[model samples]
Target chain A: MVVKVYGPDYGSTKGVLLCLIEKEVEFETVHVDGFKGEHKQPEYLKMQPFGLFPVVQDGDYVLYESRAILRYFAEKYKNQGTDLLGKTVEDRGLVEQWLDVEAHNFTPPIYSLVKIYFASVLEGVPADPKAIKENEEKIEKYLDIYEKRLSQTKYLAGDFFSLADLNHLPFTSYLMNEMEKGFMVRERKHVSAWWDDISSRPSWKKVLQDYKNPYDVLKEMNLVN
Target chain B: MVVKVYGPDYGSTKGVLLCLIEKEVEFETVHVDGFKGEHKQPEYLKMQPFGLFPVVQDGDYVLYESRAILRYFAEKYKNQGTDLLGKTVEDRGLVEQWLDVEAHNFTPPIYSLVKIYFASVLEGVPADPKAIKENEEKIEKYLDIYEKRLSQTKYLAGDFFSLADLNHLPFTSYLMNEMEKGFMVRERKHVSAWWDDISSRPSWKKVLQDYKNPYDVLKEMNLVN
Candidate 1:
């Protein structure tokens, strides 16, 4: 049986879907519209207890967590193309390190930006300027590290465009295009160049097309910026 | 040359130290006393800019991040004993999944508990009662999951004890004994049993001894209940 991924079009899950598309791997997409409460239903909860998007099922094995799903797919379908985990033990460890950095260090600030700007505009809550500023400062510090790292290597993981780089595309793209008007990767030449390179990919274009405007759905609930 | 780990004796880095002990891998420890601001020093920051503990320098290869360090040691010292990453592709993926779960789901609640009751006290701030209550509730929810999983498998990765189980010990141990007043795992039969079994191992006992006054250190700060 082919692998099946259950998730929305855009959002963070788009990273995994984009990866699958990039590799041209055969899989089924089970759309669970987040705005419609389909993901919260009992049946879906069985697949993912957290009621989160991007749950992948391969035969009898089911797994959630977008990063894990991406890693699993890449390993399972190594023949599909690029090796995201890396070719050597040290390289793989470096890849894992950067992936963790993305999760622990990078994602928190991005989530803060989403919550303050996107969530408030959509959910009818007052966004805290202090929180947003704090998060931005954190993001800037990380961007400096990325800027330095990218200056040396073409991709986040050495020469190859591994999962480490691909995994970060969804959020960085959203930050640049939709989340905040002032957000710009162009300040960092290497990061900006890499962002443009990844964003221009055909698979990424498909992701942008699929992601529906969450703000529109929020408007229905009388939640507006 | 022996593996040299630069980290404080007790901190988040303890997880990597425990892994080294469990594998019976010989290594030298360099104390980066966090209280003295050692981690933030120029030399230490050069190795890990994040200023975190448990940075391992194995000869010429320098690596940070506790999970990555654990995996590297497991792979490099494969003959030390148990193959924590798994022998098969699916097994390794499952191990990665559980590790991700540890990073995302498990650690947050535990940290919440630590921050509310322990961190505030350690840093000499008043503990928030409401935050403690909320964290305890969250800890309970995750413990139920751990109980259920432990009931079926001897260890987190199955019959064989893997890195997944070892990776969790430091946080879970601190939560159960020092921070949560031993109430976190005591009520769950399977979890409690597993804790007793794992904690009693010679390797784990050595780890505990390495960190002096385990509870008293927190108690001195009035962080332990």
Candidate 2:
């Protein structure tokens, strides 16, 4: 049976799609329209109580949380495609460490920036300049740490492109392109190179081509500026 | 060689200690006092650039981030003690899913509350009732989800106690006892029972007896409250 992933094509869902593609897993996407608040409906709530994006259904088993889904496919398909978890126990440790770093440190500040930046455009709420500046500084501090780590190793979790690197694709893509914060990546030599390396993977390229971000769709429709 | 865990016996460090005890891993503590700004010092930052609690050094390998360390020990000692990653791929997926849930959804609001609740007591900074109310409400929402989850399974991941449950020990302990927010857990039937089960573990008991939280230490010192 093919893996069924439910949610939109953008955000963390893109990360899930990218992992499935890399793992060479047979899967189909079921769109949950966030704009219509379909995820908050009772049926969707049964699968994901929090009504979040990108819940995966594989046979009798069901799972939510994109990072968890990424780990699942990576472990399940360990031999088939890109080696995500890494080779040694130590390597896996670093992967888990960096994954936490991404979740706790990197994601929060950048995500805050994303919400603040997009709220003005999407919701007509004026973005707070102070909050934006604070978030940007936090992002820069974290990127500095990333720069140091990337200098020592080719990727965040060592030389391999594990889930640690893959997890950054969705938001960092926004930071680099859509959010016009590319300089945040470009300013740091090692982080810049690392971003280029991970973002250019064929799997991510396929996800980019196949899954149009709803925000971009809105842009094309002239509904969002 | 015994693992060398640096940083104080508080917050995340307690979680690491609990995992080590559960796994029956020999480990020694090396304190980096956060109260004295020791964690931010150069020597400590070399091991953990973010200057967070609980940096573990086993032999030549150095690892930080408490949850990552919990995972490292759990995977390394999979056969020795509690099966934290879960028995199968699907179980492991649920374990990872809830772990992310704890890190992403649960930790943020509760941590914010902790800071707000303690700031006035420890630093003589007036607490913001509005922020406290918002965080408490957010935490209650997440706990409702946990109540639903625990009703179906013995633990957050499944029937067995996994990292998902263990990871909640530290902050939840703070919430239940130190912060005097036990009502939050006690009000939810399944969540209350789950908390009682996990918090009563001998390993956690040992951690509690062995390591004292810095804030509590300060209180003893007539430094805080």
Candidate 3:
């Protein structure tokens, strides 16, 4: 049976969808509205106890958390597609290391800032400069580390463009292009090159072309009313 | 070759050490002091560019991030001892989902509170109440989900013990015993029972017996001047 995914096609679930596309896996998606509190509904909670989106139901098996879903596809479909998890134990360890870094260190600040920035853009409220400055500083320090790492290795885990690199695409893309924080990645030469290289991939571009912002996501579902 | 782990035996490295012991794997420890800014020095940075401890070296491969280290050891020594990842693809997906929960959702608030609480205990200044309250609230919400899950399944991932449960031990132990947040876990019936079951495990007991706090780690290294 094809995997059934419940979440917006272009929001938090975008990464999972991108992974499925990258792996060329067959999956069906049901858009769950985030703006209208649909994700918090009891039914959604039954599928995902945390009431978070992008939960994948593979026949009887269900899994939530976007990155975990990515790992699932990468591992389950290892013989097919990109082989995102890496080959050797060393490569796998390094891959897991960067995936951890991406999850713990990289995404938090960027995601926090993006949430506020997106809401501000939608609701027409000025973002807290103090908060923005703090989060940006956090991101700057991380990007510096990324700059150093990318200078040494072509991708985060190593020469291979693995899930560690692909895991970053959606969030970082939104941060730079949507939130206008391009300088965060672009200013650092290695990071800039890394971003350009990864974002330009056919899979990510496909995600971009099919992607919708939160506002559209809400409106399309008639969730605003 | 046996893995060589460089980091404080306690502090953040405690998780990796516990995983190693749980796996019944032999490893040589070289404790690195964080207080003296040794982790920031050039030599340590060569192994871990992030300059964070517990970087584990298995022959030519070196990996850092405590959770990543846990994953590495679990995968590498699967045949040696307790299997930490999971048995099947479904189980693995669920495991990764919970691990992601530990990383992105569960740890952030508890870690933030721990840092503040630790600072308060070490220095003469008081911890920030508002900040603590905010973090505690975040944790409380997550524990409600944990309580629900524990009611359904014996452990976070499932009935079987995996790294999902072990990954939680270190910070949570500090939060409950050290920071007097037992109520956070103990107040919730299922979560409390779950905590009790996991914390009393022989592996965790060994971790507690062998672990040292950062202050002790510094002193042992003669890093405090």
Shift of residue B121 alpha carbon in model 3, Å: 3.1
Candidate 3, residue B215: lDDT:
48
Per-residue alpha-carbon lDDT of candidate 1 for residues A82-193, written as tens digits (9 for 90 to 100): 6677777888778878888888898788877876776566566888888888888888888888888899898887888788888888778657766653345888898888
lDDT of 2 by residue, B26-72 (tens): 99999888878999999999999998888999999999989899889
lDDT of 1 by residue, B153-209 (tens): 887767777777787888888787766458678889998898888888777788888
Interface root-mean-square deviation, each candidate: 1.5, 0.8, 1.2
Q: Please state what fraction of the native interface contacts candidate 1 reproduces.
A: 0.43
The DockQ of each candidate is: 0.60, 0.90, 0.71
Evaluate residue A158 in candidate 2 and report its C-alpha lDDT on the 0 to 100 scale. 88
Q: Candidate 3 residues B152-197, lDDT tens each?
A: 9999889899999998998898788766889989889999988889
User: Candidates' lDDT values, in order?
Assistant: 0.78, 0.90, 0.83
What is candidate 3's TM-score against the reference? 0.91
lDDT of 3 at A92: 82
The candidate maximizing TM-score is 2
